[model samples]
Target: MAGPSSFAARRKVKGVQLTIMVVGQSGTGRTTFVNTLCEQPLIQHQQPVAPEEAHLESGIRINPVQVELEEDGVRVSLTVVDTPGFGDQIDNEFTFNEIMGYLERQYDDILAEESRIKRNPRFRDNRVHALLYFITPTGHALRELDIELMRRLAPRVNVIPVIGKADSLTPSELHDFKRRVMEDIEYYSIPIYNFPYDAEEDDEDTIQENSELRALMPFAIVGSEEEVEVNGQPVRARRYPWGIVEVDNPQHSDFQRLRTALLQTHLHDVKEITHDFLYETFRSEKLSRSLVGDSMGAGYGAGQDASVNPEDLATQSVRIKEEQLKREEDKLRELELRTQRELAERRQELLAKEELLRSLEARLADAQHSNSSTPLPPSQPQSPIPQQGQPHPVLTPHGGAPTNGLQ
Candidate 1:
């Protein structure tokens, strides 16, 4: 967590801030996608945002970039939170703890500068609005680990699963990928899209200005066509070239839907969801502690002034003891079952090994017996069994010794 000075530093920035966190595995094109959101010349004017480029007080790596767009007549501030890639280095409990702790620290940071956050950010200021969860293009399904992580995340985060490297997929293949992911985790109901960023190229008067060079470009000024095999027939699916222009192009209906949902519905819902979870989790912990204290005092004689109070204390004690006994019994049963299962497995393994050993021993003994019993018929005579018209030894053209008749 950062010190008060760091909190003050963030508080100084005033605007309609909507934080959109982009997270994913390494090589999933997170940086490219964020650059797409910027919607400018990516490599030219846009500075590269490495994981460690922008540092915060917390150990977690994140780059904060701003995008200005107008929504409802007012300029909207889109704060893209580009997160570090997850892999062998930035993975496991330590990284996860750092991220969660960073999020926790935000609550304190916000409260300290509540007035500034409320006044400065035109959008709802206090919470994370949405999360863009980037995933490697797995044409199969959403993996179990991804779904589980989604489930455990502070439920308020509106997560949109994105398949990076969409250009590699045909239109039909992209649809299949979406379907498989949906089937795997129905709870990941949030929208999904392919990488929404790419280098924008113009195909205008430059063609007229340099006709010879324009001819050199492959498929220059041609309609987009996708090939697919349908019912044992090769088919070319065509779409207007101009239609595939914007990020999450109109040709990609799913991505368009995703963009709409993110900008409209999910963004608003996340704030309420996150706030509720925070309040409820804190409330539950407080309630549990209060109940435990009351139970302890009642059991001790702190609240035993009245004669009727003893019965109440006794009843409470009995209930607690019964619950504890039941838990112990369950634990004992589980332990016993586990031990029996292990013993049975071990016994089966031992029997298999014993059988294998016996078979090997039998084979070894038979081999030894065969070797001992066999003796070379001492010095077989060189003469062949006589047959009517056969020569005993046949000579070769360049022979030092005669060949056997059999040869």
Candidate 2:
């Protein structure tokens, strides 16, 4: 037990808030243990199911009950979460998922609360501080149900194993049973809550206290709500024809030690472990999973259901280059068409020039032919008159000359 020195630190505005979840198969005395711990009827007992309702499947349910506890002059706002029908089903794999999902959902709430732009003032962190897992005392070792349940739940919550209905075994049988259960836990490497301490960092008293508590792992618990008067004092106990089992008796059960640990001595440590290590591990795994999915979705947009493919930067670049190439090809074709038209016009001008030159040559040839035909008018000679002094001469182109003046 911690003295005055331990109470100096650790609390919230409304004192320490601790949420504990109890999970086990039915008939494990879960309801009676809660009532015994709280000293009140915090949970109602399960009634016998009728024939019609028994046939129908009742799934595992998570229900929480609130209570205020004053332990060692400290106010604790405690929430007791009860999980019923955990191992009663024919197929219990789904029940494991149901419990695990509830735990993670509480963590998810805190995660969302952290990411909010405007945080909720009254947001409650329902994350479970510790989980008291009740194992049926079979006078042997841990069954598959016990092993599987604790192994799966150890990571998310602080799993503390307790032997339910511990009074069923004799003292020697109970010791052997606890030994076997601890052995199974070790064999399977289940991370049940054992009081942890640092040898070098923690003081000697702290280390001794924690070691003493750790030695009592898998607490043997017997709970009862009925009171029996012993020595004029009413003590909570369970009655049997053989003898009466006192709930708080150290020789009979470990209820008192477990209660003190939970409510007073180690409450702060349990809450710290849950928040610092367990919940942080879950948060890291969840964020890593989401990041992986988001990375895959970046290139393809909204994953499998996306109707439109997101445009990639490389694809856009390729399309732009193709458009430029098409424009350049169009310009080249237009220039080619212009050059062909100019060449055709030049050919037409050359043909027209050749036609005009041929027409002039034909007209010249016709004048020459007309003059040749008219030259036959013949032998008529022209008389020449001499000039200047006073001589006149006439010339004829015949065998004899003929004078024009005489003609």
Index of the highest-lDDT prediction: 2
> Can you write out model 1's per-residue Cα lDDT over 1-407, one digit (the tens) per residue?
89998787656433345667776666666665555444442222234457785442234465666677554343457777666734324345565565555555565454445425235453344355566666567667776556755555534355556676565566677767766765654566533222122234534443343342222211111112234454575543333344332334445323434444445434444555555655334333333444456756756452433434545545555665577689779979999999999999999999999999999999999999999999888886776676988667777777748866555
Question: Candidates' TM-scores?
Answer: 0.44, 0.69
Alpha carbon lDDT of each predicted model: 0.53, 0.85
Give the 10-residue window scoring lowest on summed lDDT in candidate 2.
305-314
- Residues 1-407, candidate 2: write the lDDT tens digits: 87665665444335789899999899998999999999999999988999988877799999999999878768888999999888898888999999999999999999889767579999887999899999887898998988999999999999999989999999999989888988999999998888889988999998998887787778999999889997899999988999899999988989999999999889989989988899777765555445444656766343442432334433544554576588779978988999999999999999899999899999999999998888455587776556788546555566566464654
Q: lDDT at 403 for candidate 1? A: 67
Tell me how many clashing residue pairs each candidate has: 2, 0
Candidate 2 TM-score, C-alpha based: 0.69
Q: What is the lDDT of residue 285 in candidate 2?
A: 56
For model 2, the superposed segments whose C-alpha errors exceed 4 Å read: 1-14, 298-407
